[model samples]
Target: MRVVILCGGESSERDVSLASGRSVAGALLDRGHEVVLVDPAAAVPVLAGPLRPGDAIDGFAVGKEPPSPAARQQLRRRMHAALTGGPVLELLREAELVFLALHGGWGEDGHVQALLEMAGVRFTGAGSAACAAAWHKGRAQAVLGATGVPVAERVLWGPTANGVPEAVRRLLTAGPVVVKPVADGSSVSVHYVDSLPQLTQLAAEMRSGEVELMVEPFLSGREFTVAVVGDQVLPVVEIELTTSVFDYTSKYQPGAVSEVCPAPVPDAFAARLQELALRAHHALGFGGDAYSRTDFRCDASGEPRCIEVNALPGLTATSLLPRAATGADWSYPELIQRLMDLSTR
Candidate 1:
């Protein structure tokens, strides 16, 4: 089968997406499938023609900091023009299937998926509707919560925070609160703020014409995540945070946080995590053949609340979903193959 692996978009998680694309491309190539790696955010030589059987693509290691908002916007404009008038479209047209290794921004927010669907192509991961709902953490959690899944309550601040002071004041009544971007991944710009002064200060610092934030009561207990592919629920992966919050820096920084797969929890706790993960995945309308990862954090009473679901979870080396798959005895290549088989089914 011919596969076009799309990655490295103009999002905060661009590097991580590139790393995922490289991993998938290599694995499929190793398994004797023709693969073409394309980075819509930049120029890649392979996009000049049809899918090729062998192409050694590398040097896409993740960076510590994501591109600034200004930079990302600029890149997005440039990339949009390039994709509309470049050979990348040609490759997309010729490929038998497209594997989306993208995360965050339009890639994971339904824009790209809708475009692909309109073009009549089969792709890996969830459909456009699912991606849109999953990208917005607050909306996704609300859908899950409405379906009887417990979730952390959140107050959103749209493109421009309408009432920052009011939101902060309300969230402070519940002790501490966590602030995060409304539609981003990899925990970028996430803050666990305790006092009103601190939260106000953070809000003031981030206050801009395009700031999208959401605040929720902080859950101090353990943080857990699990992946679901089709009907298979992978093992639980526990996150051990090193700081007040698992911000983007801590998430990608080595030794910043330890991730334990098949988490050292009791049998019942593990089972609960698995059950909730799958529930959150399906509650968000993700298809069975697609894959997703759901996150949760326990409250003071040790009861877990669903946080959010990731439609296109990372496939990087240190990513939690892949680690869970490894704990389930699925090698990296086998997991990739299984996803491909399921996605094209």
Candidate 2:
């Protein structure tokens, strides 16, 4: 199959996306498929044919801070122009299938997926609507909650803090809470706060438009993620981060955390996690062999609470989804091929 692996974009997760694209390209090539790696941000594909395991992979360094709003807007415009005109777009339309190795920004938020669909191209992962629902954390949780899935108590706050619901404000005062960007992944701006002062500061930051956030009572227990491919749920992967929170560094950097697959939990508890993951996936309208990764944190009573769903889950060598697939005894190449087969089905 001729595949174009779309990777880096203007999002804060661009580096992560590039790494995933590089690793995926190498895997596909090893399986004897024609591959082209493209970074729409660069207005062209790598054109190097296929990457080898030992090849050098280059991308921007991820910092603790995110890109400024102005910078993001500029990059979006550049990427839009690049995608609409040139050989890269041509290749995407011509390819047998396009593997979406993208992580954040317009790439994972459904904008790019919609465009590809309009161009009559088949791509890996969920469709546009499902991607949109999964990209927005608050929306995804609402959809899942409506379906009777176990979701954490959360309050959505937009730019200004004045309009916050009184009930939500009360919930914030009762216990430790988590504040994070509703539209981002890779734990970009996630913060765990237990004090009034910290909540005030985070709210102020949100009002400044630095970030839009959702607050959820911090669940003090184990964290596990389950991956769903087509209708099959893979094994659970328990995340043990070095820090109190799984921030950007702990997620992408090696040795920052230890991930255990087939998470050493009771069979019943593992089955529950898998069931909730599939429920969340289908609730968001992801169907026909679509893939997703759902995160969970066990509550005090040992019940798992759904955190969020990642439609375009990372495919980096060390990403969670691949680890779960590996736990199910599927090799990395086989995993990539499975995704390709599902996308083209």
Candidate 3:
């Protein structure tokens, strides 16, 4: 199979995406598949053919902070005219499938998926509308809640939001709350706030930005994630955080976070998490080879609550989905093959 893995776009998660791309490309190459790894934002190929293991795997690091906005803006400037035509499109049309390793920005928000659909190219992960639903934290929660999945009480705060302070106060009444951009991934700009004054100040700071933010009660029990791949639910992964918040730094850096796959839980509890994960996956309209990871955190009551579904999850060496796959007895290369089979079926 010929695979064109797209990565490193004009997104804040560009670093993460590039890491994922490297991992995916290496695995696919090992599996004896013809692989062409490309960063859509690059004018010339980031790496050309005669692809070797180290060539595609080199570079692309995940820092404690995401790429700066100014950096992303410059990349976007260079990318705007490149993605529409020429070699990138030719690669998309020539490959058996385009595996999107992109996260955040236009990549995860349905724009890239829509473009692929228009070009008659099949890509992995959910369709455009499902991607849109999963990209917005508020919308994902709404879809999950309506499907009877438990979700934390939240208040949306943005530039246009009125009575923001009072709404935030309502969430704070429940206890410490999580404040984050409604659209980001990899925990960028995500914070834990336990005081109204702090929350208010942070809100003001975030409000000054263009993206919408939201405040939701922080669940204290434990953190876990479940992945759905081609109608199958993989093992549960429990995230043990050294800090109260699993911010960008803790998530990407080593040792700060510990993940236990098939998360040491009673069968009943694992079943519950898997069910919630699957329901969230379906509620977001994901199917076929469209894979997703539904994040979970239990409340004080010990009941698991749905966080957000990641339609285009990270596939880096430290990514949660791959770890869960390992727990399910699938090797890294086997996981890639499984995704390829399901995605290109």
Runs of candidate 2 with Cα error greater than 4 angstroms are 43-47, 50-70, 163-165
Q: In candidate 1, what residue range of length 10 has the lowest lDDT sum?
A: 43-52
Model 1, residue pairs in steric clash: none
Task: Write down the TM-score of every candidate.
Answer: 0.94, 0.93, 0.95
Q: How accurate is candidate 3 locally (lDDT)?
A: 0.85
Model 2 lDDT tens row, 178-265? 8888899898888888877777776786668656788898887889999999998999999986676778888877788999998999
Best candidate (score: lDDT)? 3
**What lDDT score goes with residue 143 in model 2?**
89
Runs of candidate 3 with Cα error greater than 4 angstroms are 43-45, 50-56
The local lDDT score (0 to 100) that residue 138 gets in candidate 1 is 78
RMSD, model 1, all Cα superposed? 2.1
Off by over 4 Å in 1: 44-55, 159-167
lDDT of each: 0.82, 0.84, 0.85
Writing each residue's lDDT as its tens digit, candidate 3 over 1-345 gives 778888888888888888899888888888877778888786675454546444445646787778788888877876665567777788888888888888888889998899889999988878899999899999889878998999988878877875556878877887899999999888889999998788878877877767699888898889999999989999999999889877788877768799999899999999999999998988998986689999988988898888889988889889899999999999999988888787766
**Which structure among the candidates has the greatest TM-score?**
3
- True-structure RMSD, every candidate: 2.1, 2.4, 1.8
